[model samples]
Target: MIAIDINKRIGRGPGSFRLQVKTVFQFNSVTRILGPSGVGKSTLLKILAGFITPDSGLIKFGDAVWFDSQIKYSKMVQERNVGFVFQDYALFPNMTVAQHLHYGSDNADYINQLLELGELTSLKERLPRQLSGGQQQRLAILRALSTKPKLLLMDEPFAALDSALKIRIMERLKSLFEEQQTTVLMVTHQDQEWEHPKNQIFNLLSQED
Candidate 1:
């Protein structure tokens, strides 16, 4: 289980608002987080991933204590076993598609599988600048999966892909994630992008601080 009871202050002065949430996310589940613009949806994911620290509260995932503000304890990002796909598709300009996956994992077979799943096997040697926006996005997702993390966090990861490719990738990812029992937390403004009965919607705007 992933339990989060945290409070953060976003921005400074008059623009700042209290960001507080207390929710227990189930294991092996896909949760899509939604809220009004500037509600700290992405920040919440970063905090969970240990990239950002909350002003106060505790964050626990399974048996791991990711954060405990009272004690000033926060786990490092690498030790959190998290795979994150950022909104900008944070790919390295110097690295090729194959190289990106290789950097995260040493298993040749798994890396090859990731390339095939992303439909990037043929373009494995191409760098980010040589690829289209959708291709770059797919590569980003594949790079994150190279580690086979227990928890995956994605922030608007499908914006570049078209409807057809998006569906295909999501379908394939669903199979792999189910097999690995991986938990996913995603931030998306579009509800139609993820239309499935199994996906739980965690609407931040609907929750009281």
Candidate 2:
């Protein structure tokens, strides 16, 4: 289980608001985080992935204490073994699709499987700049899965793909996640129609709520 109680201040004055999150995320579940534009939805994922730190909080995942504000203890991003697919894709400009997956894991067979799964086998030799927006997004997701991370965090990961491709990828990913029992936290403004028994929704409401 992942339990957290975090608080962070965003912006200043009238435009500012406090993002206070207190919740427990069950294991081996897929959670879709929803909120208004600037409600700090992405910030929550960032904090969980150790990319950002909250002003005060206690983050515990099973036996691991990811953060403890009172003790000034916080885990580094690398130490968390999290796979993150940013909204921008965050791919290496010079690395080809194959190279990206290989960088995550040295297993040749596993890498090849991921390439096939993402339908990126033919584009294996293409670099980020050479691929289309949707292709780049696929490579990003594949690279994240290369390591079989315990926690997968995605920020608007499907925004680049069309409805058909988006649904197809999500379907494949759902089965893969179930097989690996990987916990996923995806940030999206709209809910995808696909549903799974382990799927969950985390709605971050306005401060007034």
Candidate 3:
């Protein structure tokens, strides 16, 4: 399980607010974080991923302590073994689709499986710039999963895909998640984008709240 209680100041002027969040996530479960703009939904994921440090709080995952304020201790992003799919699909422009996945893991069989799952086997040799927006995003997702991280964080991962394609990818991902036993936290503004009986919803409060 993941436990957190943290706070941070975000932005400036009318768009600013104190982002105070406290929550626990069950292990091996799927969670959807929802909120309006400026609610710090993405920021929360950043904090979890170790990109942003909280002013004061603690983050614990099972027996491991990811962050601690009193001791001034915090784990590095890479040390946390987290797989993050950024909102911008942070791909290496110079690298081919296969290279991105390969960088995440050295297992040839697992890499090949991921390529096939994303239907990217045919385009493995193509670089990010050569692929469409949807394909690039798919490569990003596949790369994130290549490591089989314990916690997978995604920010608007399916934003660039058509509804039909998104559904297909999501269905395939559901199976992948089960097979890997990975916990997921996906941020989305559109509620209809995901629907499953096992999905737990966490709605962030606006600063006004």
For 21-52, candidate 1 gives per-residue lDDT tens digits of 99998888889998888888999999988888
Query: Given candidate 1, what's the lDDT at residue 208?
Result: 34
Error of 3 at 25 (Å): 0.8
Off by over 4 Å in 2: none
C-alpha RMSD by candidate, in order: 1.7, 1.5, 1.5
Residue pairs whose backbone atoms clash in candidate 3: none
What C-alpha lDDT does candidate 1 achieve relative to the native structure? 0.89
lDDT of 3 by residue, 94-166 (tens): 8999899989999999999999888899999999999999998899899889889999999988888888888
For each candidate in the order shown, give its overall lDDT on alpha carbons. Answer: 0.89, 0.89, 0.89
C-alpha RMSD (angstroms) for model 2: 1.5
Local accuracy of candidate 2 as per-residue lDDT tens digits, 3-118? 99999887777788889999988889988998888889988989999988999989998889999999999999899989999888889998889999989999999998888888
Clashes of 3: 0
